[model samples]
Target chain A: MPAQTIVPVEANLINALEDRGLRKTSARSAVTTRIETASGAFTAEQLCRDLPEVGRATVYRTIRHLVDAGALCKLPMLDGAPKYSVARNEHHHHTICSRCGAVEEFRHSTVERVMRSLEKEIDGDIVGHRMEIFITCSNCLAESNRGGSSGR
Target chain B: MPAQTIVPVEANLINALEDRGLRKTSARSAVTTRIETASGAFTAEQLCRDLPEVGRATVYRTIRHLVDAGALCKLPMLDGAPKYSVARNEHHHHTICSRCGAVEEFRHSTVERVMRSLEKEIDGDIVGHRMEIFITCSNCLAESNRGGSSGR
Candidate 1:
């Protein structure tokens, strides 16, 4: 990766928010930074706990702002909570662990093409799609073998 | 699409749930029917009103069972509710109208290929991606010209 290119969208994102009349407070910035540097899907509660200084209400507001601004994307989890991830222009879908919620990003051109062909066969014209691949992560697989109870 | 095909599944599904030890109430049957016949994503609340006698908690529990049993696929809405559709072995994405929440399912084979090629080209190794195409449905487009909250 180039040292300065994509140097994290935080600074530019903050200015963008300020222009929209949303304050660039620490609470918002912390939330933004956490999202910008994050690897996979996360919830607002997860962000709040990571950045303890951010208030509960502020965390909610920041997440709302991020999604509205296209800075983050929201996905439906089987567990029913709305999870957010940093938005990237490049397209892909996740392979998630059902037990622990660990996520892996995947890119397979063949699968993508096959999916598209399927869509064309189903609907005359294609508009869009959401591809989330679920897998039991290695750690979660281990835990399941241990007979753990919390699906939490 | 065949009536006979659906009739047996309806019978077996109820039996299966009972085999798994869930309550066999009308609410459960209605929820199962809706998901079995649904052409697109939906929420538990949509079924709540449809099956008036079904308690809200039961509606939720049934949806949970459907997902757990792989009878339905959960899709996320931008607003935070988990919407479910009939389960399938294949993968595709969705195109949603921002205002009216009308969703149409579609696919793009080249988009994934392009994302993968981009991932490699940029050395980003794309992990996952989500794409939602937003446009006015034909009715919504017509309604908007008359200035009704065509979607909102």
Candidate 2:
């Protein structure tokens, strides 16, 4: 019988990670995988749901590390918890349901164009800006019909 | 000796507020003033610190009501509470401090222009966008040199 030693996984990704002083533990990889596979913005609790063995502190650390390293971005919700999304080259924003608290991704660029025109219009020494669109999603609409949320 | 009944102070702001179905209460005006004077983003708790008489529940209710009416907007933060800001006619973004958590506004149109051009290049229909530029504030930088935040 032969005993097996630990074989390092995620060779390439871990190498890039090590260059930035990040640990290549299973928890890190699990958190990364979950975030990568997420359909949209995620709360820490949501990330922890998939990464069962990961600690809350570890999840917070991973989020901070990824955000600092430009691997992810944080979206703050009005309800207190912040949501994290994978950073990408494409510019995007979210449309959140106000009534039932649902979040969805909507692709549109008029916001970008308007921001650019405004910068030219003002001599205020243009910098950067943010855009968030709020919408009542279809699921929330259904929920509203079922007497779940008021003021829809 | 005759004493007169105190006439309810009906301020013009309250009169205008009445149009929206909200009562003309002192607490409501104070909350509105705080939101109006806030330089950047602020949480309900932070707003309460300035006006001790305003209850947390009142702050929450007022903020929610204003946001529902489109008179205000919520800025997503990286941590802690979700900050609220008054809605404006044009679009803009914020840069927040990593240390003291102070926020500074940025408005470089080049970034905005590039986003617009990029959207067109990809054949994507443009709608709206939020741009946030994260940066360390000077006060936090100074304090960090001396020591660190007592606690944020």
What TM-score do all the candidates reach, one by one? 0.63, 0.59
Which 10-residue window of candidate 2 chain A scores lowest in summed lDDT? A7-16
Could you tell me the lDDT of residue A119 within candidate 1?
A: 53
TM-score, chain B, each candidate: 0.64, 0.66
Best by lDDT: 1
- iRMS for all predictions? 7.0, 7.0
lDDT of 2 by residue, A38-147 (tens): 57678888887777789989988877777777666667765667777665544566655555455554445565666656544443333444455455556655656787
lDDT of 1 by residue, A42-86 (tens): 987888888888888988887777777866667666455767776
Provide per-model DockQ scores.
0.19, 0.21
Pairs of residues clashing in candidate 1: A92-B128, A92-B129, A93-B128, A93-B129, A105-B127, A106-B127, A129-B93, A129-B94, A130-B93
lDDT of 1: 0.65
